[model samples]
Target: MNDMRMSPNLALNQLVAQRRAAGESLVHLGFGESRLPPFAPLMERLAAGATRNAYGPVAGSPEVRAAVAGYFGRRNIPTGADQIVVAPGSKPLLMALGLVVPGDVILPRPAWNTYAPQARLAGKHPIAVAIPEECGGVPDPAALRESITAARVLGRDPRILILTLPDNPTGTLAPPALIRELCAIAEEEGLLIVSDEIYRDVVHDPATEFLSPAEVAPASTVVVTGLSKSLALGGWRIGAARFPHGPWGEWIRSGVVSVASEVWSTLAAPMQSVAEYAFGEPEDIRERLRASARLHGAVAREVHRITIAAGARCRPPTGAFYVYPDFEPVRAELGKYEVTDSPTLARRMLDLGIVVLAGHLLGDEGEALRFKCATSMLYGETVEEQQLALDAPDPLALAHVRSLLERVEEGFMRLVP
Candidate 1:
């Protein structure tokens, strides 16, 4: 079990730090952190509530829960405060969900590494289903049904399906029609759906429609969302989960609450205060989120263009800050330099002073020669610089970020040429 759990991004980060410490000119594209600073008013709200020192309820305070419910309400999901469970981070909340949910975990191949491990940790088997070409999180509906039948034939109980709307490594959004189809299957098979919508707010197109599973299949769906991606508030550690409305929903929710009491106990009072403020539909907060999405969308598009031009195949990112580039087109050139596998490609990129996670780490085939590059790390070093860039008339042309872009473009070119 210990051998099964590993974090490729963390390993890549360590290598990046090592190379930089040795005075290597490293271009870091590893960790996916929002380069923007926290909204000024959000920080002020947290500071004002700094004295909230007591441990709050296991689910969260009523105000915070109500705010989260209202947050989803604005998005057309009819949720209430009772359905909201706030935790330190979506990771733990997801782990708790895994623990409470029964049956084998259904994971899309090439997913965030933790999904499989969380299932294994919760004492369930993780069955991987290959995702369709269009998206990285949810398996193709036909493929999913096939896998479910295959698993059951092999005496496995594949009953829980986890999906990422705007996937992490691939940075692609699952289309609404595909989501509706998957929901239909989940309904037929009696499978629990865990939709990780952490990156939904950072989606590139304002006109792109997103269909939440809760909207499509409210009876057995649990939507997991948090401020880690959208708010650049990872350190704040605020996450929320919305459970369905049914007897089984209460059972699963109770199991998660019980686990929370024994594990994390409760979310921090100050962070809960932050969540209360951020989740409420305030105009200032909405504007801040809008600016952030614009910046992220612009930068991600630029990075995607550079990678594509460098002779790699990458789906144009629709959300999040990732570009999963398959270097198969340049495999001959890569092999000439002894870079034959994904790990070698990752190491070679690091040697060239560009830090990116190997696709193999995210469950892609080792020989695939693919990697996930996080473009968000291109932002400026200082909080003041981040804030200025966030408000700049031309955010994409910010000096520091453009410099990082030049570095990435040069690095990829060097790799293939």
Candidate 2:
């Protein structure tokens, strides 16, 4: 507990900022920050709510919770105000779940970095199960059952299973069939599933189908999401969660509120105002969401093309602004650069003026030659430039965006060659 390193993505973002401040020009492909500016309506709502200063309920203001409940209701998940909890960010809600949920946690092998750390903070073992070959987020059904049995055999209690929809590090959504299969396994094993759907609204294609674990195994699944990734509200720190509707869900919700009372007290008043309006998903807000998704998908696909052309086996970006490219194919050629594993490979990229989060930082094997490239950071350095990209019919056609993509391409070409 005394010596765990800071989350790698945040650390790398700070490092890149410091280096850029010192006049070093580098392509930043490390952080998943949506480079878009906030919609005027969201900021207006925050300002309007500024006069309300008193602390509210431990869960959230009833109004905001109702709005969030409606947000889920429209998505076909019947949610109630009592089942919603607003927090500073979904990260803390997830951590609180970790603290409250009993037994060890199960996680995808290369999952969002925080899941494993949060589980450890809760004094539980994090069992790593391999993800399916076709997509990330959900653990492979067969591997999950085996992992659970093996952990129990070894005297570890595997209880909670955390999943990511449109997973971080690898921006691919798990197919509906696969999600159902995994949900069935959870039902059979009585595992509590925490589905992290932060990137749900950022799907590249409007026609892409998404299936929530809650829709399948509603009795035991808790869905968590935040405005940070989808609505570009990272600094404002607005997040919400929908608990299953039952006594079991209520018990977990109660424990979380207790944790929240001791920790956050309540979501900030101004943020509640913002969350209420944002989670309502009004017509104007929906348009903004669609535009943002288009921009993310455009830039990410270009980056994917660059990675693929550079001879790396990269997945096509489907939901988020990321591509997890495995460099194992070029390991032999990379020996000259002293790049043998994730860290060394990432170090070589940074040395060559590009920043990438090594796969190991996301809990992949340290020896695996892989890394994550966040395509979102390629948007631009300034508000005006980002807005231009957002409004453009073809974001990559814009010079500022194209130049950054070119830099990534050049960087990868040099690394692979």
Off by over 4 Å in 2: 1-3
Q: In model 2, what is the error at residue 289, expressed in angstroms?
A: 0.6
Worst 10 residues of 2 by lDDT: 1-10
> Where is the poorest 10-residue window by lDDT in model 1?
1-10
Provide the global lDDT of candidate 2 against the true structure. Answer: 0.90
Clashes of each: 0, 0
Per-residue lDDT tens digits of candidate 2, residues 312-346? 88768898888998887888889888999999999
* 219-293 per-residue lDDT for model 1 (tens digits): 989999999999999988999999988788888889999999999999988888889998995888888888888
Report per-prediction Cα RMSD to one decimal: 1.4, 1.0
| Residue 294 of model 1, lDDT score | 80
TM-score of each: 0.97, 0.98
lDDT of 1: 0.87
What RMSD value applies to candidate 1? 1.4
